[model samples]
Target: MPPFSRVTVIGLGLIGSSIARGVRAHMTGVGLTGYDADPQVRETAKAIGLCDDVADSAGAAVTDADLVILCVPVGAIGDAAREFAEDLPADAVVSDVGSCKESVVTALREALPGVAIVPAHPVAGTERSGPEAGFAQLFHNRWCILTPPADADPLAVERVAEFWKRLGADIEMMEPAHHDRVLAVTSHLPHLIAYTIVGTASDLEEVTSSEVIKYSAGGFRDFTRIAASDPTMWRDVFLSNREAVLDMLQRFSEDLSALQRAIRWGKGEELFDLFTRTRAVRRSVIEQGQDDAREDFGRAHD
Candidate 1:
């Protein structure tokens, strides 16, 4: 059976719409409702049947929901919660899909005091957004990490975990602070590097926009894919998790300096050693079914 029959989702973007569609596909009899701050998004969600209902307001969406998932930028969790705070049922378990957990947990708990807040990040997405961009299979084989507050209800945590599991995500639990620190290196740093590299390519005075587009084949093309992600979400993620992201950025800068020194001195062995280690990491990801080893990172096939 599904963990929650009446599920309400706030913010009908890619993640929110995907969850609603996933629930519809995999969990029969579940009542899924959705609402977004943008009226156009609400209309799109309804047109696509992303949820059973596209509510006109956040409070109306969560009126009788047992599970409420806030799917918004990391910095907007509190504001989204406050939008429907008075309508959330006492037993409704509040959760979120914010990449940064520590700040989101604090915001959710503070905004919806005494409510069950279980922060989660489904480590899965494409370089897409909006209701029309979501698919039911987006979470399949992906990791969904839950970072519940210290005093959060154990039952609430389990229920939220179960909910994600039904959506084909592997559930992992950790503290909010630790989750933030870990994602800083794994996700935030990579996106930051991608954005920087892509921006540099675009701003190069010697390179024309047409030339850059024409020559993008391997590495630059891949970076552009990541850089094409929703800017608002990435902006909020970096700002909300500034401390951890900055820490990782510092480490990345030091490593980059080492690489620069090695290149300047023609240290082939050092470069080869690091390349081999990183290659093994990619192999591990493929072996664990976290990604595909096929061309275009499985994009062409998917």
Candidate 2:
């Protein structure tokens, strides 16, 4: 109902730190507490004054928190939820910054019966990791998709929406399954392709590879940026969200094969039509201002 006074953030890395900074700057009455499993991240978050208090464990951070955000890797969402489930304040609302919703929702629901769990995916992150990579404006104008269950409390959902809105996110509500399917196409597959191509490039001879790096202009370099993301995080994302990712991957492979056939058969019309359609998609993104000229650099530095 009222604004949360005590907010606990689990996993004080980039996403968590960004939320802390945004809340500190915007949510005046909220008392922010942070916790990270990694000692280094915990120390860094506190050293930089990211939150009012940095706790050593999840339970301590969430004890009195009115809002608790789990910011760990997707696979760890359940464990983090279980760790603090019993200690969560009776009326506390739990949410997350996990990329995939369905899996995270299942994880939290299993661990936190009756606790309000709103799974949120802020579609805005860089390839970078750690608290040092975050900024208050990281979520500005970005989409934050909330996948609240059908019977979730409306007031609880509103409170979580308000929190993200105050942090500069444009909110959208969708079913967890729909959210996962859409993101599988838009995000997961793209990441998979990037990793594949980058791995291909890495296998090239040093002499040729150095030149490839020196000369990469548009598409190749773009893949490199995505490929540069934290390996552990991406690995977990792929393994946990395997079904959706694989379905998209299978479709993408078929499309790639069609493109190969068109090129081999010298079917310029087919190739041109495909390129035209893809270019139009890029144009739409540019029109939305989501694809800035500096997106690659921004992704690299976070």
Candidate 3:
């Protein structure tokens, strides 16, 4: 039998819909219910059969859910918890697909004390949003990092871990604070850099609008894709993960300054060394099945 007989998903956006789809594809006996804050999205979910049922209210969705997964922005987890607090079953295991863990763990602990709260980050997504953008295979072959508190129920943790495993995700455990710090560098900083670089290009559009668009074939276009992610979602992610993100930003800023000095001083050795090291990192990622090593750089496959 599956660990969860029924799963309640709050937020019918990309991740939520993808989870629902995966459940249907893999967990044959599990029932899925979903709710989104926006009525239009709720209707859209219903229209496309995004879930077995789309609840009109958040609390209604979690009424009988054995596993309730909050799939909203990290910043809104607290509010979502509060919204479903009264309706959540006393024994229900609550988890979330939030990027940052510390704030989410704190938020859930404070908002829904005594509940089984395990925060997870499914390291999978595209520069897409909305229910229609999701597919059942989105989580397949991706790492799902779980950050459960020390006092958390062992059964609950295992249940959640097995739940994700059934959906084709590799589960890894980590401390909440450590997850925040690690993701701040790997995911958060990259998004910040993407937004900044894309914004700078847009600001200089009057000067290089045509050239920018025309020449943004391979590299610059990928940056644009990352920057084009839902503005509200990214805004909430950066704000909710403020401290860790800021710490990483400071470190990145120092590195950028060093690189600038190296260029100014015509330090070819420094440039080559840094480039070589980063190239090896990319190879490591590819070898570990984290990304495709195709020469086409993600274009041909897509």
Instruction: Give all candidates' CA lDDT scores.
Output: 0.91, 0.88, 0.91
- Which whole-number lDDT from 0 to 100 does residue 156 have in model 2? 88
Two-way lDDT contest, 1 vs 2, winner: 1
lDDT of 2 at 37: 90
Q: On residues 1-302, what C-alpha lDDT tens digit does candidate 1 reach at each position? A: 88899999998888998998899989999999999999999888888778888899999999999999999888888999999999989999999999998888888878999998888999999899988888989999899999888788999999999999999999998888899899999899999999999998999888887788998984689999899999999999999999999999998899999999999999999999999999999889888887777956766643
Q: In model 3, what is the error at residue 234, expressed in angstroms?
A: 1.1
Error of 1 at 106 (Å): 0.7
lDDT of 3: 0.91
Candidate 1 — worst ten consecutive residues by lDDT sum? 293-302
Pairs clashing in candidate 1? none
TM-score of each: 0.97, 0.94, 0.97
